[model samples]
Structures are given as C-alpha cells and as structure tokens.
Target: MIAQLTALERTYAAIILVVIMCVGVAMAVVGRGDLFAVHGWIIAAYAMAVMVVLLRDIDAPEPWEEHFREYYDDPTKVGIILSLIWGVIAMAIGVWVASLLAWPDLTFDAAWASFGRLRPVHTSGVIFGFGGNALIATSFHVLQRTTRARLPDQLSPWFVLLGYNLFCVLAATGYLMGMTQSKEYAEPEWYADLWLVVVWVVYFAIYIRTLARRREPHIYVANWYYMAFILVVAILHIVNNLAVPVSIGHAKSYSLFSGVQDAMTQWWYGHNAVAFFLTSGFLGMMYYYLPKRAGRPIYSYRMSIISFWGITFMYMWAGSHHLHYTALPHWVQTLGMVFSLVLLVPSWASAGNALLTLNGAWHKVRDDAVLRFMMLAAIFYGITTFEGSFMAIRAVNSLSHYTDWTVGHVHVGALGWVAMITFGSLYALVPWMWKRPALYSARLVEVHFWLALAGTVVYVFAMWNSGIIQGLMWRTYDPNGTLTYSFLDTLVAMHPYYIARAFGGLLFLTGIVIAFYNIWMTITLPAPVDEGAASDLPVEPPAPRAWAQAGE
Candidate 1:
C-alpha cells in the first residue's frame, strides 16, 4: 500500500490551530507575552509540517534496489565529505589557538585576529561544525544499514547538509567580522541561530521517519546513542539561543537571562553541549563501527542498554561542575562533582564492553588498520573520562583550572578517541560505498596511524607537564610570603613545551594527508565485480581460522 497521511494530516492541521488558540489565550492571561514570540512559534511549527510532507513525498526505494536504481549515493555522502574536510580545518584552527596560548604574541595585536575572538571560532568549528557533521553523516549511514531501507527522502538530506554548512560559514565569518552575542559556544548572531533551528528540525524529522520504517527486529544499540544526541541537542540549542536581535546585520543582541542567572545559563548550555555533542554523539559511532570492524558481535547486548541510559541520566547533572568555585550555589557545585564522579562507572562500562567484544578476534587488531583505530579509540576513551572526572574534583580544579591541562584532556578525546574512530569508520565506509576491492595502500594507513599516535602522545604530555609546572610555580611562596612568581615567569617557562605541541599537530596533519591520497587512489581504480558477477569467477580455498590453527 502506498502510504497516505490523509487523516493524520488533518490532525496535524487541527493541532496547529489549537496551538495558536492556546497561545492567544495564554498571552491574554499572562499579559507579558508578545506577538513576536507567538509568531515565531507559529512559523516554526508550519515549517516543520512542510518538512514532514516533503519527507513523505520522496519514497526511498528498498535496499536491494540500491545498486540497480542508481541510488543517488545518499545525499548524506556530501555531509560526510564536508565533515572530514571541516574536521581537519577545525582541528587546524584548534592548533592555532593552542599556539596562541603558548605564545601570546602570535596574535600580533590585531583586534579581529586576537585570541579571544578566535577562541570561540576554534571551539565552535570543532564542536558544532566538525563534531555535528560527523554525527549527522554517521547517523544517516547507521540508520540505513540497520533499517535495511534506503534513506527516507531525497531533498531532505541535501537541505540538511547545505543548510548546516551555510550556518557554519555564517557563524565563522560573523565572528571574524566582530558579530556575536558574546556567549561561549552560542556566540553566533541571532540570524545564524535562527537558520540552525531550521536545519536541526529537518535533521530530527529525517531520523524519526527512517526509524519508523525500519525492518529490523529491534532498533540497534547505536541508534539509541544517536537519538539521545539528536533529541537533547535540539532542546539545548533552542533554550540557550533565545535572544532579541537588535537587527539582523549588525549582530547585537540581548540574552533572555541576566547577570549570574546568565552565567548559570551559559555554563549549563556549555557543559551539556560537551556532553551531548562530544560524548553522546561519539558513543553512537563507537557502538556500530567498533563491532563491525572487529568482525564480531558486541560482547553483551543488555550491557549496552544499561550503560546508555545510565550515561544519559548521570551526564545531565554533571554540567554544573564547570561552575565550581564560582558564584553558583555550593549545593549545585557539589551535585555536579558527585555526578561527575558517578559518570565514570557508566563510561567505563561502554569502554570495557568495546574491548571485550574483540575477545576472540584479537589478532584482527594487528592485521586491520580499521580495527586498530577502533581499539585505540576505546583506550583513549578510558583515559579521557578518567581525566575529566579528576578535573571536576575541587582539589584538582584548584591546580588545573585555566591551565593547559584542560587543553590536553580535551585533545585526548577529540583527537585520540573521537577523530580516530571517525577516521576508521570513514576508511571502512569509503571503500564500501565506492565498491572498491580494497584500499590502494594498507601500508599508508599504517603509516598514518603511527604519525597520529606519535603526535597525540607528544602533544598531551607536553601540555600535561607544562600545565602542572605552571600551577605549582604560581602556588609556590617565598619565605617573605610574597607572590612567588609573577604570571609572566610561568609563561616564559612554557615556550619549549608549546613548540613541541605545535610540531605534534603538524605530524597529525601529515598523517591525514597520506590518508587522503590512499583513499583517492582506491576509489579511482577499475570498477569492482558485482556479487552476482563474481559467481561466474572461480573461488579460492579458505584459510583455517586463527583459533582453530592455534589449538592443535
């Protein structure tokens, strides 16, 4: 049966009218609500409806038809490519910011080019632009694979990718142009925020409809993590970006919250943005790609569910940890610290589960670069989570707050863990999508791994030692009890470590360049044989399983 939404469509229309009436009555009752506020809601709802209608129109084909129907290559492919390109650029900007912190004079005293403006640029590019695009691309890929259905709609995937990139371009350019709301991660001007609202809603619809048509016995474990990320981020973005624009072009705006309340709101948005954006979203990639690359099933099906909900429950409370030793209430800070410590249990559960899943397939790690990437990503995940919980502790916070240690911890996750897994997944996916026999150069992939690994090791250790030394120097007191060392003294000591960190970043970038060449060659080679066509060719005898050969 060709599906029809006739009755549901009528209900949707009627609900919009009732929502309008309710808003009118509430505005009259409250006496402070404005026409503009209600108008924004009405327009937002209508745009959502249009998207739903469009989603239903495309009628994505069955999976078996993918090869023959000349599948449009899933418009999400463009989003994945954008994610990879932006991942490099974002990390490059991060390296620039890291360099600035190490050598403050790198800015050369230009206002627009200064560290303060570029800091937000670095953070947003990596988090929202790079991390966000990775989540979108992988979710589309995972959803289609699990559901055994083609992507739900045509125009939607393209709309999402283009609209999102437009948002990124606008936000990046606006920051350089001195346009912002001065919020940390939410600094984009009101116009750009509004544009994101549109892109995100389309993303939500695309995910939901794909789930609705799924043919699997149950939704896979990975979808749970991806769905949580999608859901929470929508709520977070809307609440944090509620502001009154002075005008579209000039970029001035007023937040809905004021004073300490505003600070509270900002960190609340900030930390959870890290939670949902970096932690939850990457967990999605881990669940799917980790097992697939290992050529094995996940160790425990039930454990995945338990940890998913546990992390979700625990992480939302840990956001207040950022406000510790600040004007925020003591109880709130304590609550955050407690939750931060508790988060370790669930986080370790996911990490351990990933490693244990490879129990019988350990040698795959030596042979498969993709497997090696995933396994090491799990190892880094463990290190980052432990460091994160320690930093949230008040005792450690006293020494490490505002130091380079924070930067090191973040890169352990971003570069060592998240970027590693994403790269491995892309390596696996590109060949599959292009239907290539194998990567053009496995040796190149191995070389890329060593370079990235060496870079991350040097980068993290340099920051760690320098940060601890700086903290100790500042806290030291002479016999006179005068301030022991001026802040500048600590800065002078950090030059060598800073130089090392920059060189490490260059090594990591070089690895990515090698990967680009290897992948490009693989895709451009001769066409692969179709599964049906391969039946006409002779088959070779299979090698004995590794475990069986070892036994006797």
Candidate 2:
C-alpha cells in the first residue's frame, strides 16, 4: 500500500488540494479584508488539504491504462465524419434562420418551426453540435499525438462521442417537441442538461487522465485551452443551471435566480459561454495546429502564458457588459466595462504573437491555404476584440445596443475568427487523422476561402449599417418634439440590408457544401498501402523543442 504513493500521484493529489483550498480562502478573504491573517490561514489550509487528499490517494491503486486493440482508426474516422455531418446540418439551419430574419413569413405558420422556436435550434445546433463535436474530435486526436499514448478504452472514447451526439439528438428533438426552459443558450430542459453533465464529467476526467499519463515533461498549450474549456464550462453550466425539473415529461422549469438577478445570471452565463466555449477553445486549436502547419515556432512563450491567465481572469467579469445600462449594480457595470477594455491587451497580445510567428513564413502565407486561413483569423481576432471593447463603452452601447452592429461584432468573431480557425485546423487535421496524402483540391480550398470571406464581409457590413440606422432612427426626434420615424419605417429601411445578408448566407452555405463534397472525395478516393502491416504502430516522436514555444 505504501508503495502505491508514486511521486507523480502525490504531486497531482497535492495540487488538487491546493486548488481547492485556494478557492475556499479566496471566497473567505473576499468576504472579509484581513488579508495577512487570511493569507497565513490559506497557506496552512492548503497544506492540510493536500496532505489529507494525498494520504487517501496513497492507498488507491493506479488505474490500468488501455491500448488500441483494433487495427482501424474507427473512433477518429467516425468522429470526423460526424463533425462534418453535424456541421452541414447546423449551417443549413443557420441559413434557414437568416432567411427567416430576412422574410419572417418563411416559417410557414408552423408553431413548432417558427422563428422563436427555430432560432434557438439553429444557435444550439451550430454552437453546441457542430463546434462542440469539432473540438472533441480534434482534442482526442491532439491528446493522442501529444501524449504518445492511445486514448483511454475504446468504449469510453465511443461514449464521449456517441453519448455527446445522443445528448444533441435529445436536445434538438426536445425543442421540436416544444420542451424548453426558454434560456437563450441553456435552452435544453433539465433532463437533457443533466445528461450533458454526466458526459462532460467523463470528458473532463478522460482529458485529465490522458494529460497525467503524457510522456512529455510539459503539457502542450493546446491542452491548457482545452482543459480550461472543459473545467470552466463545467463550473459555468452547473452554476447557471441550478434548476429543479417540474417533471421529466414537463417542458417547463424555473431558474434559481429571479428578476434582474436572473437577467444578470443569464447574460453572465451566455456571454462567457461565448468566451470560454467558442473563443478560448478554438484559440487552443489555433495555437497548436497553426505553428505546426507553418513549420514555425510561436512568437513568444511568455505572451501565450500572459494571454491565457489574462483571458481566464478577465473574461468572467466582462459578462456583465452584456447587461450594460441595466439594473445590475453600477460597480458591476463598471467592472465589466473596465475589464472589457483592458481585455484588448491580452487579446491582441495573442493575435500579434500569432501574426509575428509568421514573420519568416510570409511566402507560405501566399502559397499555403491553411496558413492564410489561420493568419486571417488572427487578424479578425484583433478586429473583434477592438469592436467588443468599443461596444462595452456606455456611449457606444447606447447607440449599438439592440442593433445589427452587435450582430456584426458577433459574426466577426464567429465567422471570421472561430469558423476560420476551425476550418484551418480541419484542413490540417483531416488529412493527418486519416493518413491521407493531402487535400483533394487546393483550388477548391482557395475558392472556398474567398467565398467565405466575401460572404462574411458582406454580411457583417450590411448588418452594421442596418443596426446603426435602426438605432439612430429609434432615438431620432422631430424638432417639434415628436418621434421622427416609426419603428415600421426602420424595419422597412432594413429590408435591403436583410436581403444582402441573405445573399451572403446563401454564398456561405454553398461554400460549406463545396467543402463538404471536397473532403468527401478526398476520403473516398483510392489509395495504396503496404500489404504487410507491422504488428505495432510506431509511436509519435516528442514534439520538437521549438514547438515548446507555442503554449507553455
């Protein structure tokens, strides 16, 4: 039993306890201002907690790690396929919603399929289903490569994939069944939410265990973002979704908070859901795959660490900016705005770092479609951060709030930054995961990139113009002290912008379908392999020392 306490296990067990103690002491110290005393107590409490957990862990036998018994990379293949499938579905629904906005009558008078119902369906499907699957599939691949070990048991990996997709199925079906909590992002009812909680916990445990067993001396930067995404999302989901189901069959339930408090909590959850889930998670993919593809080292190791911690700390407070000019305390609003503005530092620090990493690789920027996508994403990351900071200012919020300008800001991040990076990573990952030579058509990739870019720019500018026009018109007053333009007039004025947006969406959808077809052809095309296969696949070599510059 004494022999069970390996140095590594003891180290991890101690760190876990220190983390717990730090959390508790943070709460207490914030509650009271006796910092010196609290600091001393916190250190003691952390040491004690570490000892206790370590003592318990000492007797527990280490788990037996699993090896891949099957010859085929079924999980990787299936996951990639599912991610592509869901991505198309999600984008299709998104285009449908865009059309619905352009012309509300497209709902066809079906209550189950109306804009109110379908909007959430599209958002959840894309954000959770498409983006979520992509992250999981790629993380699994990256984890394996970085760790130099096979994933946990095949069954559990399957569980993480199928179980998650099953949750998505339940969620989409429940919405069609008119079952919902009506929360913006957390729309799934309690049962579905509960199901997701279980899947996510397994996801987290698998990730941690994988990292723990890694052969590398230091963890990769991508793993940091991935793990942060898993951990913080767990905390956010549980905190924001404190609800009791009326019944399993019932579609309705109440949140734990009420009134303005509820609004605060909802946006708090909503905005950070964007920050952690959408932003930080993809940033991890960018950090790992971009430099790997470019055959370049990261610009600065210190900058990456700064960005990581800065984003982790600053993002939580900036959620209140979503509720600006509301009844949330003035101090809270102030905190949100300040952090949002200051967030530009770390955000651009990351963006600049990525861009600078390409200093010697500018020629590749012209020749490599993957680098082009990633570099453009970094540029847009800088743009969106600037826009977000500007929008957080009360003066700007008064004009842009409840307008198409905000929609433009979001799409800049979504389409330009997040989707672009995902595409880049997928372009690189798909071939590597499948052991294919390269993409079927570089020309198709170029066409896809240009179409996506044109569509995004057109869509963003149209909405920006429409939103600002509407905002100004709403606040415009006649010199004789009467409203200058009715709301109907503003809506009518937006028709042209809406039409342009729909056209852009159509182009974007077509480009995605083209990409899907291209990838499909790549997979289905004939290939050659040696007749005599080795009994054991070769292990991946450790990442080069320069690769260390990316994340640590």
| lDDT computed for candidate 1 | 0.76
lDDT of 2 by residue, 456-536 (tens): 898899999999999999899999989999989998999999989888877777777877888888888853454443223
Off by over 4 Å in 1: 1-72, 102-111, 528-552
Q: Show the lowest summed lDDT stretch of 10 residues, model 2.
A: 63-72
Q: Please report how far candidate 1 places residue 367 from its true position, in Å.
A: 1.1
**How many times do residue backbones clash in model 2?**
1
Using lDDT as the measure, the top candidate is 2
Write down the lDDT that model 2 would get: 0.77
lDDT of each: 0.76, 0.77
